[model samples]
Target: MSPTIRSLVIPVTDLAAAKAVYTALLGAPHTDESYYVGYNVDGFEVSLNPSGDTAGPVAFADVDDLDAARESLLAAGATEQSAPRKVAPEARVCVLADGDGNPIGLRGR
Candidate 1:
């Protein structure tokens, strides 16, 4: 199964400041912010995670089969940051680092 990027959780230190910037950039306030600030713009869902020292960009993708996706990524030379683990009752997530230490999170049920 191929993976499709479903959402991106950008780590931002300043929630208020970043919200304002994103609001201007997206032309509206985030659609959802109570649980986690999320802005749906141009067919992309940008989620703002209120923690982390994210120095750069990160990508999160959704896969139909998490095990297969993880295997493919490993075969493609990605290094595991975290093995697949259930974060919810019916879902699992994993993370890997690419050649340049860029993180990519994988999610599936």
Candidate 2:
């Protein structure tokens, strides 16, 4: 299945500060949470993560099948950074690295 880039996960040192910045930029209040802060702009989702581990933003593709998408990307020269993991009851996500070592995330529900 063709994937669509519909989400972006940004690692921030301070969740509150990031939320304020993103809220002002997107002109919408973010869904605040202890683990993640999310903003819905139009149809795209922007998430602020407080893990402080990511080097940069990770763009997430919306896929119909998480396993299939991971397999396809791996076969197409991407290296799996992480296996599929459940984020919610019905949502799963995986992380991979492209040829240039950029992190890419895949999300399926």
Give all TM-scores, in the order shown: 0.74, 0.89
Give per-residue CA lDDT, model 2, range 1-87, as digits (tens): 678999999989988888888988987655788798888889898888898666889999989988988888899999987788898
Tens digit of lDDT per residue, candidate 1, span 2-109? 678877777787778877887778766455564357778777778776664355445778888889888998999999987888856987977888898889899897
Off by over 4 Å in 1: 29-35, 83-91
Model 2: per-residue Cα lDDT at residue 88:
86
Worst 10 residues of 1 by lDDT: 49-58
Candidate 2 whole-model C-alpha lDDT, 0 to 1: 0.87
RMSD of each: 2.8, 1.5
Candidate 1: give its CA RMSD in angstroms.
2.8
Model 2: residues >4 Å from true position, as ranges? none
